[model samples]
Target: MTTWWLMRGDVRVGELRQYGVDQPTFLCHFVSGPGWEAVRELFEAWAAVQGPDPDGSRNAEAIRPLMDLGLTLHPSDGGSPLTCFKGCILRIYGDRARLRY
Candidate 1:
């Protein structure tokens, strides 16, 4: 299974946020499975619109819109699809960490 993280602060600052949910609580919410395909689609669209690597050479700013979209997609759930997917992408791409305010 893929793991996710929630990072605090912005691309300017590399601060990481603690996982807000405990494992049991996180597991409960996450068991339902988030729409990763939708998340990928949104991220690709955002990246295309934002252009490549606005902040760093890695273009962390492109992920900002995905974080915003997560707020809409995952509503009351404490587990964030944006954060999760961002972590996934970072790992997949083997790129630098990306964070958004």
Candidate 2:
């Protein structure tokens, strides 16, 4: 299993868990934060685009807010995943911290 922590500075905001190797599925959870509303809107927009076969360009636009928020994706065991969104992966060490996400 591969876990990615979404961090804002020293605080944890969300988590993304990847399961399966051949057909990977991501389980994501996000917490309420200073910019929760904006994040929620972006997430909803992303979901709308994911109705069927999501468009890569539209999906990129949808996740742009998350990137702008400086949310770093930290992987467990200090190793990078094979694939990721926008190629935005920031490796960090340590166990999973407790947070709303």
Candidate 3:
């Protein structure tokens, strides 16, 4: 039971530009702030769906939220059971945070 939630709007990473860079890079954002409970829920759900990867199952709940957040994956890359999320800002100007399981 992987639960997914997409971002409805552009995410804001505070304090950037000072370093002088371009676009921001992020895999995901938690608008409600970093709540460990949420992370745990997401992680558990993802793991459940992943099960034994040998079966080659896709976790819809986990992936849906990611897609809703506007996080686009490179065409060259395929999705995996491992969930990796990042709270990031412009390379040179913004800040960064990571959420992985």
Candidate 4:
């Protein structure tokens, strides 16, 4: 299991926790912080996609938090990628952090 720091500058808001060969889980569990709202939005949007109709069917895309603002899809061992918003400042961690472009 690998846990990467989802950081915005020096402040750590959330985490992308990978558990074995399966898909990693987005741990957006935050209390109070500067970027806490963004993490909360992500957590809410992602939480809605949980569970399934036996075959794993879900509703609309969980990209609502990244609506008007920009988006970055970082790389991980998880099959379904995780979303982390670092405000307007865009910083790429090589191939690990990409703009989905």
Candidate 5:
């Protein structure tokens, strides 16, 4: 599975799977940092549900935990047959971090 490096500028907060739930080897560091805690919770929720955006289907519940954390998907994904599956939220949060830090 593809992995996305969740970074805060030069620093890597963690890596998340590109699709499906992360494996046992998933890594989450800097728990107290910007994206770490939220990302951890998102991953746990995804793992418990098997995966997010399953079979290219929009998994609303999979991302519910991140709603308050500022996760947003492209509106195209809101309709039947998503534009792309497992769309990353890192960009949104990363930008937020950039502004704050």
Candidate 6:
């Protein structure tokens, strides 16, 4: 399993986890915060495009919204696999974070 942190600047807003090898399942858990609605919409859109399997071309399309929101993917440091998957990180834009405040 791989766990990714969804961060808005210094604050953490959500998490994503990937499980399985032959058939990987990605789960996203996000907290209520700025741009939450947009994020939710994007998730829904992604799901709609995903069909039965998440590893589809639409997956890339789904991630585009996140990038537009200034979210970048990063690799997390070494951690317990039971607690978190290794090398998974996503950060929200600082500018967007400030807008929420």
What are the clashing pairs of model 3? 4-65, 5-65, 6-68, 6-69, 7-68, 7-69, 16-93, 17-93
Estimate the Cα RMSD of every predicted model relative to the unseen true structure.
11.8, 7.9, 12.6, 10.0, 12.0, 10.2
Best by the lDDT measure: 2
Q: Estimate the TM-score of every prediction.
A: 0.26, 0.49, 0.26, 0.35, 0.31, 0.40
**Candidate that scores best on TM-score:** 2
lDDT of 3 at 62: 60
Per-residue C-alpha lDDT of model 2 across residues 8-63, encoded as one tens digit per residue: 66656556555333323243333344533444555556556645545567767766
Minimal lDDT window, size 10, model 3: 88-97
Q: lDDT of candidate 2? A: 0.48
Query: What lDDT is reached at residue 47 by model 6?
Result: 46
Over 6-56, each residue of candidate 4 has an lDDT whose tens digit, in order, gives 444556544434333322322222223455455555545545565664543
Weakest ten-residue segment in model 4 by summed lDDT:
92-101
Instruction: Give candidate 6's error at residue 48 in angstroms.
Output: 1.4
Candidate 1 has which clashing residue pairs, if any?
53-59
Descending-TM-score candidate ranking: 2, 6, 4, 5, 1, 3
lDDT of 5 by residue, 1-101 (tens): 33344444444444433333334332222123355654665645544554445474444666565544543222222333211124433322322211010
Error of 1 at 73 (Å): 15
Q: Relative to the unseen true structure, what is the C-alpha lDDT of residue 64 in candidate 1, on a scale of 0 to 100?
A: 62
Q: What is the lDDT of residue 87 in candidate 1?
A: 35
Worst 10 residues of 1 by lDDT: 9-18
lDDT of 1 by residue, 1-101 (tens): 22333233321111122234343232211221234443445445544544445456345555565556433222233465454444333221112223222
Is candidate 1 or 3 superior in lDDT?
A: 1
Q: Please, what is the whole-model Cα lDDT of each candidate in the order they appear?
A: 0.35, 0.48, 0.32, 0.39, 0.38, 0.42
Worst 10 residues of 2 by lDDT: 92-101
Query: Of the pair 4 and 6, which is ahead by lDDT?
Result: 6
Candidate 6 or 1, higher lDDT: 6
Checking candidate 2 for backbone clashes, the offending pairs are none
